[model samples]
Target: MNSELKTDRVFLEIFKNRVQAIVEEMANVVLRTGFTAFVKETGDFGTYLLSPQGETFGCPLDTGYNLSLGIPAGDVISSIGQWNEGDIVICNDPYSTGGMATHLPDVYLLKPFFYEGQIIAFGLCFIHSSDVGGKVPGSVSPSSYDIYQEGLRLAPVKLYEAGVLNEAILRIFLDNCRIPDQNWGDLRALMAALNRGERRLQELVERYGISRVESGIEDVLVYAETRVRQMIEDIPDGEYEFWDYIEKGPGGYPVRLRCKMVVRGDGIFLDFKGTDPQVRASFNIPTLNKQGHYYLVPALIRYFRTLDPSIPWNSGMVRMITNDAPSGTLLNPEAPAAIGARAATFIRLMDVLTGTLSQAQENKLPAAGAGQAAIVMLAMTDPVTGGRKVGVVQPICGGSGARPMKDGIDGMDFAVGHLRNIPAETVEADMPILIERYGLLPDSAGAGTYRGGCGIDLQLKVLSPDTVLTARNMERMEFQPWGRLGGKAGAYGTAVKNLGQPSEERTGRIDELLLQPGDTVSFFSQGGGGYGSPYKRSPQAVARDVRNGLVSKDAAYEQYGVVFHESKVDLDATQKRRSAVYGSTDEQQSFHFGSAREQFESIWSDEMQLAIGAALTVYPLALRDYLKRCAMKEIDDRFHRGEQVQAIEVAEIMAAIHRTIAAL
Candidate 1:
């Protein structure tokens, strides 16, 4: 492979860039024709052109999440039957199509790029539409219990037949959605993006010859594969396990997720067999097959490349990987399971992977970061305009975890990259809400030798009578972003209504409460965890943070063992505090995390969750909710009766009880 790369360095570089250009053109088409403000303004869609063999060669360089296109597009092409000219297949079946479409509202369209009646490649596009028919205004919510409730599931249906749009299918979709025009327009834009990819591929074939272009695709994969292997080989191989939590799902129970990976030589296997079984709520991952693993591979690869930058990002990097998730786990759900907002699970997956890799090579990885991205889509029915208004109040994100030598980036992009926050001015112009404030939260950042970057705070006042806040991927409330080594944990996130006026803070629920005039909503995002001991942090850094208004002078003196005098940090006083608080290296005592939450977490391990999930599966979500409450009461009674916590050895039963307690 290296010899091949050496011989074709010039050719590979040119071919790679050319394929990238094709994807860029595809994205441009989508942006030009897209109707919704989310897609046009924020550019939340993706396009890719793959080889007939199901390898992503070229993808959109800007806009949308490109990594999303790689694995799902490959899975879709492989699932279909013999292809022909003008065959466009549509699929939003999260289970059948893998993590391609995490939920129903994300529509995925794929068309075979054919030449001379021979299918040579495929063009694919996906968009998060304004709506799909569901119990809620939008198709997603943490609490939704079934896919049917989430929205319509199109299982590889033909959106276009013999080069013509399927009007009947279009009508069905339009009738089911609240915003028909926006949905139709987004669908058309996706189609246009697909056509652009097809045209670009055809042009490449015309210029470079069909066979050469095909070879180019294969060559890109081969080249990428070799580079990835070399990169893996550079790292010392070993088995590593890491666990992270999604504070709570719609069911109000914290979801415990674990990842046990074996990195051997140039290959890796992610074993999720011990993971918690599928939940009754929409938090379940709908992908039935191993394809859901694709969602995690890009993130793992990205993390790996951060250590070794020479690795190429084409399909080859992860070709040697295998995912062994149990059938009923959240990572691989069974039939009839609801999976409306599976992105939350995916975020957990990324976090676990990051943690595992970090454990394997501490110096090569960053500390645990603000893993979950806060995605809130605010929609309102304006009585004055008589039209639906939608806006993104904030694309909330937390600070990145700190590194060995450097502090983590604040409000960074996690999982899929390049997702930009919508400007406050745009939200006001397009929607009925007025954005009161949008800025970084002072002192919300994780404090350590290298402090984690801070997350953002957003305050919005409702202007209309009815405003629906459809929030997804908001986590780290119960379990703050964890730190590594000797670092401190970051602050938890919260959402409150009627701020400072009989307000209630909500951690894991979405509601459509009527908004009276002067009602305000305040949102605070989670902070990323620090990397090392706060006392070890440079005094100058703390002084800078104080001077910049990021850390309060009092906080610097107390939490961070730094001192300030007359609005300025006193270097000698800070040094004295640091030495007194932390002591000398030899005399310093190791920080101990006691049993404050240990016993609580013991009952919520992966093994126990499966038993609880099994019982819940036998009943519908509503009945399960009642049973869960009873189980928690029983546990509380037992606890009060002087029962030893260790005696509760029934993992599943214990987990079930813990789930209920956490929910309550």
Candidate 2:
């Protein structure tokens, strides 16, 4: 056959299916043979096939952990320098891998697929291991100040060389981790999956000539790029800017993220110029300035997929997009900036990108969601061995935002959709904990024509002493989820210990807490923001929601102005109430941020944020972190002390910051 025929559309699609099947089989092998609760029960693992140059060619699509499908392996490939048959390499250092592995707990393994004494492709897989040896038992904490405290940082190194297992490296890993046996078993499962992928890939190369297989990879990527560029061209060309903030960081300070997107013809540019400098906490996201990373591509990909699912999932999807996240900022933090809780920042970044695109595309996007992952980890002493055991009790997620024509999904967030929560039965059997109650929170969703989804409420009791609970990405406690197009904002999240008793303590965000037996911990995730005006909603729909216990009678009347008597909608009364509650249609506000955020933004306006970013740009990178803290502290102190500052006073603070940068 001619070269043209080998790279034809039909042949390229056939090869793509073959490669995808190989990765799916690899994932199945890991799922069945893995030894940890993360892999076996939660399915927190991913498998992919890569080209020799380290671009992802194929990955499973129907699985929950599809989040890792677009991760690039080029850094690991380049670090190895050379590849041989039957050799395998491993690494989990986010900095060394250009943020490919994300955090140190995610252990990655790669093996080269050889054909006729030459490397044709590579097989790759990663799993969130049980432990990697760090200051915390789970090896991840939001309070961590640097990477050193996160976990064991593994540079690119050969775990197996020429079919021989590197025993020395294995010993080093086993000696450091808290659960040595669990880690060893999980690593072996990864190796087995890679071997299965290698066998399947070699078979494909033997069936179709090696040259045709190689050409098909190139054709698939080119096709994806063409499809995505066309999608970008469909969007109106203009510059759109959106900004969001994290409520609190490690030092009890809020951080802002600014995104300015420019769409011209068939390409887009994302510049995070006014985002806050990187904090000393683990909330930083290590994007490494790469556009292909999911931190930059997922939001766009999600939008495109909603338009057309036929678009191929590959690395080339990011080819039409470019990013400029200033170094030392939260998006592209410098080395040693703790990234253990990077997921918190990543979820909010997705929201900011969605918000910007919503402005540019107006009716084409949905309103903002909860915008946080809300992961909960529990560590307790093993009753049999008296050894510490750490495991994820619940990877809890909030609701998705309401769509233009439909309501948001209840009790689910897009970011953590790939990770399944551990079943209550498994949690009770494996750990010394009792799940008291778990279900959706009522009357939590924002009220609108198309109401947003509700968040979750979980209550658990500790059955063992010395249990430590660490929950990351607990946000929206101070600022509720913002609404769009005259919709009302959603409720915020909260964490409380001993709910009804006098010892009830509200811990908005838990880093680490010690509990005794019989202590109850309750957590409530934030709901999604609403879309459109609440008065536009049908009274019948409100009555149904009230009957189903999702909406209370008081909220239905107060928020939506829909009167319900004995679970029945009073049509005449509803109309009169809505007209009186909301004065006039023209006077209705388009967006509602609730009272907390509105109050905060009045003091810290968008212009002030930009001025602070510009002034910090002139300071040395080493001093930027300190200067940012000082500036925010001044504002935070006055805001908390119930003192109001005029706009002129805020501008003077900005001028003071500029003078400090110049003096240095």
Candidate 3:
């Protein structure tokens, strides 16, 4: 181990805050000068200061999104061959940079900071562009089959060489994308943010001397690692495994995700060995087989924060943890696999991690929330100019799961850094749509002593003819978010059009829809899972929820065993009703996955998933996706066709799969 630096605790704390302030300043610059609605309104951007080794040393906690916190740029930097003082490297390729940029729409820029003719640090910035020239207007579609169909994929290339702009590369972006001016403006803002961070880093070096500044950074990282390791050691050493499924895949098929966590001493290992193979749709996460920890780091930081609020936020926090996912699985897809909609799978993975840990430490973890971001994008023709106007209507999200000590937050999804919803006025001004209704869904939260958060209900009326719509990350439609310790499961959400009319249409998670003028579209997000038993809730709390329009009177009485008479809770009657309903004490289970998941898992059990995964391992890597798809199709066909399938039938199917594998 390296010798401990002479820096004191006071100096280290001060320097940590100073570095965070610099990154915050960098984010402010980008937000103030950015061009697209996604960047300014939705805040889809990130800023960070990276060490010479490309590990993130500092990131803004108050201003930018946390999705890019674990993006590693070491490979991207090294792939560029060499760098100069004014050079800026740009990349969006997931495979080349070890999954630094998960999708093509997120454009990343990196710049090196130099002091005394030696590179001291790097400034990194990324933003989700509105358009990058793809098969769809928004540059992302759930139906896209490959990366080539998603958008232009840029490998690590020099956007600026020795302070000289590369006009050729700039022209290529302008000529190919639908919104050239907006792309150019966002790119310039990213460059400005990088420059701002680089200048601030140099100033820090000048004030504290290069040696002291570098040592301070190293000390901060070591401090973070030590704190996290100590926290890991506290948890009882054992192996905890969990399995969950995605309700819909590329062709409306179900995809399964399994996780096994082994905590031994100060080290933790996360293995995704029995996860389903990569899908044909855009839901695959290109984690580059186990090298990328982008999907695992965010939840770990959140977990560690509960233990030690002062733990430094940097790449070093993950040093004591290791991640492993088999190649060609949903977490680590091969080349050309569409990944534009990978966030759908990524958030579910977060739940898998949370669920696995909750098994060991139920008191420390909350239940599952609305596990995905329901982003609605609309493309319509301008009435006056007859030109296409494409923009995000709203990134609708749902509530958080209930905590041990408190209720979950209503109408907010905390998994994705608490992204704010776009105001209704902003949507009307940008697109030809009117926001009719936007509020919470009544009785949507899971029922428990401390209730889970409620989901949202949004209604939009189209004012333009032939308006096209694309919605991504729509999940929890079939299997409701699971609850813990006897808490009831939350309600699922849906998408429908032309409500209360003869031509009214209802659809499952859709890729695109053409709507005529005056047609209405509605989106209802899923609620979070509750934490504890519902019978233990106070009658006053249930009455308050009913009065506030968050819970229905009937549901409150039925689910919570609360008695209400004419808008008032009868304390004597409530106690008698609770006793009659629950009979002494409420029966509790480790997990309550609701009836939908229970029915689905009855046929597709954990043993069946493992057997299929093991059979595929015998085939060539290139053929695994195909074999897995065929096997899943057979299973889904029996259920979808309304055929009664028993355990014996499923066993026979597994036997047939093994036979096929042996023949191959």
TM values, all candidates: 0.90, 0.94, 0.95
Name model 3 segments beyond 4 Å from true. 1-6, 290-292, 584-587, 633-664
Clashing pairs in 1: none
Error of 2 at 9 (Å): 2.1
Tens-digit per-residue lDDT, 482-576, candidate 1: 67667766777778786677665553444344565567777787667777788888888888888777788877877688877887778887787
lDDT for each residue of candidate 2 in 406-459, tens digit (9 for 90 to 100): 988888876567767678999898888899999889888987888888998999
Best-matching candidate per lDDT: 3
TM-score of 1: 0.90
For model 3, residues 1-664, the per-residue Cα lDDT tens digits are 2355456888888889988899899999988999888888888888999888888889877776854546667778788778798999888889887888899888899998888889999999998887888998788888887889988888888889999999988787678787888888999999999888888889999998998999888888887888888889988999999988777774555788898999999988888899988877888888885442767656667898777878777877877778888888888898888999988888888889888899878788888888878778888998878988878888877878888878888888668654667899999988888999999999889988888899999999999998988888888888888787877778888888988888888878868888899999888888888878899988888998999999998998899988788879888888888888786544467778989889877767887678778777766666666666677778878878987655445545755875787798
Better of 2 and 3 by lDDT: 3
